[model samples]
Target chain A: MDSLGLYVLAAAVLFGVGVYGLIVSEHLMRKLFAINIMGNAIFILLVAASGPVEGAPDPVPQALVLTGIVIAVSATAFALALMVRLYQETGQATLSSRDEGDDG
Target chain B: MTAEALALIVFLPLLAACAAVAFPGRWLGWIVRIGLLPLPVLMLAPTLAVLDQNVIHLALAGHASPLGIEWRLDPLSLLMLWLNVGITVLISLHAGVSFRPDSDRGQRFWPLWLILFASMNALVLSADLFNLYVTLELVTLAAIGLIAVESKPAALRAGMRYLLLALMASLLYLLGVGLIYGQTGTLDLYLIAEQIEPGWLPVTAMALMIVGLLIKSAVFPLHAWLPAAHGNAPGPVSAILSAMVVKVSIYMIWRLWFWGAAGWDLATAANLMGLLGAAAIVYGSLAALVQDRLKMIVAYSTVAQLGYLMLLFPLASTLAFQAASYHLLSHGLAKAAMFLAAANILSSVGTDRLQRLAGVDQRRPLDVFALALGGVSILGLPPSGGFVAKWLFLEAAWHQQAWGWLVLVAAGGLLAAAYLFRVLGVICLHPRKRLNRRQHREIPNLASVAALILAVSAIAAGFFSAPVLSLISAGLPPGVTP
Candidate 1:
């Protein structure tokens, strides 16, 4: 009924969508998109929830969340490169721990 | 030095990262190398000086919090900041010599790495939750970008997996923040901690937030993406990812537990985390022992090392906190050295399989020694930082009369020793001809030196714990028994 309630609902939906995307997505890029969406939702919630301490959305949490988003992207890009190399080497996109023969 | 100097320490690298994109192909490597020049002397020294004093607050543009960016200097932040900058410089320099800039992959790596450093500093100095989040996001983006720098499909898949997990964590964290907002309407961690009551809503908030952080820290079950991401990446990238980036989330959890969510009913959650950490210790070490590839072993070892940080929660003493912080620094150096040593081996042998590295020590003694130093440090052997860290944790647990926690701490050290010695054994005993059959190429001196410096520091931490401990105790809350 209020702004907080609306934000909470939005966060729940965002979380659900992120989970669903993480489960169903096969391509790494699409998964990245889903993850970004999830991060955005979290950022929104953190800022919204801070609730304007002293007539301003608590700047501290907002700054932290912003830093988190950037870190997420950096890590994502690095992982994608690693994935591409893996595919280039082994000719597979999906992760499978199942190997035919044990090295040990 | 003004806050402007501290700001420059973080942003200069970021500016270089952007400038790296603008440079010509041949000059990018030199430009990146030059970019790191000011960091060691300019950024780290003053930070250490600041840490020796009290908390130094810098408001960007002379504006205070809630309206402008702020950089807060504390011992914990200083420790992390120095390590991040120092290691990034070393990694960048190592890459300059070993990495072939002509390769499209190498060109992109430098810029992203600088950005990652900037984000890491921002995260360290961040005073409040929202600021921490923003810097964390910057870190995630650049880290993800670096992972995909290899442009390999597997790396891409790993990146995506990591992204998905990170996203989920953020969302959960957000939900928790939302709940807290509904209850207290403040986001500044200290303020919220002061005003909030120990009710169901706050409890839910705490749980959600901790879980989100746990996912990022990759404690046990949530660590699904770490091995593939770190093990399969390019060598320098793996070093960065394993050595420091992952620790950022753990640091966040530290802030939350001790400062942010101080009075939550943590008995259940602490034990839960401790159990998961214990599982990680045994499972990750066992997993590492059986791994064929060199980097995979180190990657799994990271999972186990991460478990060490969680041990503090169960012990839950000021000494435990200090031990955790100490261990964090020790492990950062040791693991970075291990990864760098592994990279050197990979570059030389053109493969990182354990069996193939039997005679590697004969050819590259410096590298082998570097690896051995890292091994000893990580195993918590005497005179190494890891040993002191383990001792502190055990003492803290003993003081609490928590016998189980002591055993957990000891068991982790033993497991660490087992896996580390396994690698050492393989290095010493195997036939020289097998490794020597491939032509031996001399590793760049800078890489070896970088690894050695870290190894030495890990050992030095044991002797020099006094200053660091005192600095960490500068602004303690009342009743915290350090």
Candidate 2:
């Protein structure tokens, strides 16, 4: 496979793992990590869509990747803050509503 | 003038966000009010010249449409903007009094709220896919943060779950954007729409985008996140969350399929969505009727109201579009009024439980009036916005002879009335407060006034349908004209 195909496949794998973790993981921190993985996967896929450039890389996807990374970082940091605060207040790392089984 | 007014409308909210933090905590609440002073000038300016040929494209930073970021202001955007701004202003007015700047939640709430407003305003005006992704993320983060503002365990848990689901939705949406970009080499929605041929990639992208929007909008089967998040948030927070945030994705989905691209005969697809909507209306109303907490009831009703909008998908027509827009306005105002009033009652009485609520009307007459008036609209009573909108929907369905949809519309309205009257019945059965009557006096608060204004406006919407319809018609998006 070409490098572009490899990148796309890697993104797909990362995205699958992230979605799986996001849904199945009980802990909030793991979920946040899953979100990060998913975010990275999207970034990879976006960069891949930009195609390979030997002389000069496409600026559009590069610019988008930079902005996406910033947004992801800020979102991750905020989620982490929330996770820590929830753990402190309730002494539990998982969400209570899930344990309550109200989702059923 | 329209361009300047629109630009300021988007940016002034960002200014409010900064002022929320820059000013001293004591001054923050009132100071943000001062920042809102610029929006009223849009009222003074003449109406925007929306389109020459079904689109009024504006380029930012002196760049033209093909290269620089582009924005479009069609009727849908204009209508959404007007509704969004009206709700934001009312809620902000309520917030200034309800959340004292010195309060813990208030200090964190104002900045995020103003930023959410800016993001939503930008999202509606945006004409491109990549820009929409950024604004959507901003909106989701601000909304999640608002949900967690209370920092209580339930609120935190709700907020975390909301964040997870919203992130998932955004990823799905972004993947669609990626697919479209890979195929079309452009992120501008109109350009992408033009280049989109009925192929595997285009079809897959459309499906992904629609699924993402459905989840985010909490339409039916994907609706579990909404009740918990909206129900758990603080009052004005829930008001905007229920009224505006959920609508944005659905609005975008509408723009994509019906107006922008995906012009192929998705007749079966539209009918399927209509079926899901029917389920949402029935299930959501039943769920709302059984909800113990008042906010939970309102939140579930939001799911049902969203379903009402989805019916427009199957019955796509000028009348149906107009009906959906009117209903959206009607529901936004009425629901905001109800949630704000519920907040007043919950805070004053210390419980949102139906059995515990007694003499709330006596304590807060204006707030009760707000709830009742809002209930009237939700129930689709005459001389209210909901009634007019539903009537139009019924007429549209009948004209198309979509008999199933006609039945769903009638049944849904009846179910809405049933659930709404349940709350009204409870209110009328007001028991004497545990506290002495003299101890519980109605203290004046702007929240009640905000609620009252929204309630009055929802009723007023029924009368001004002609003008609103005309305004909406002015900026209708171009039909598929290859």
Every candidate's lDDT: 0.76, 0.82
Most lDDT-accurate candidate: 2
Fnat, model by model in order, equals 0.43, 0.55
Off by over 4 Å in 2: A53-57, A98-104, B43-46, B51-55, B65-67, B430-443, B480-482
Residue A66 in candidate 1 has what lDDT? 70
Q: In candidate 1, what are the lDDT values of residues B287-319, reduced to their tens digit? A: 988988888899899999899888877777778
**Decoy 2 TM-score against native:** 0.94
DockQ of each: 0.33, 0.49
Q: How well is each residue in A1-104 modelled by candidate 2, as lDDT tens digits? A: 98998998999999999989988988888888888999899899989878754666667777777878888888888888988988987898887654321211
Chain A TM-score vs. truth, each candidate: 0.80, 0.87
Q: How well is candidate 1 docked (DockQ)?
A: 0.33
Model 1 lDDT tens row, A1-104: 98877976897698679767867877666666677777777776766667653575665566656765666666566556555675676677665555411221
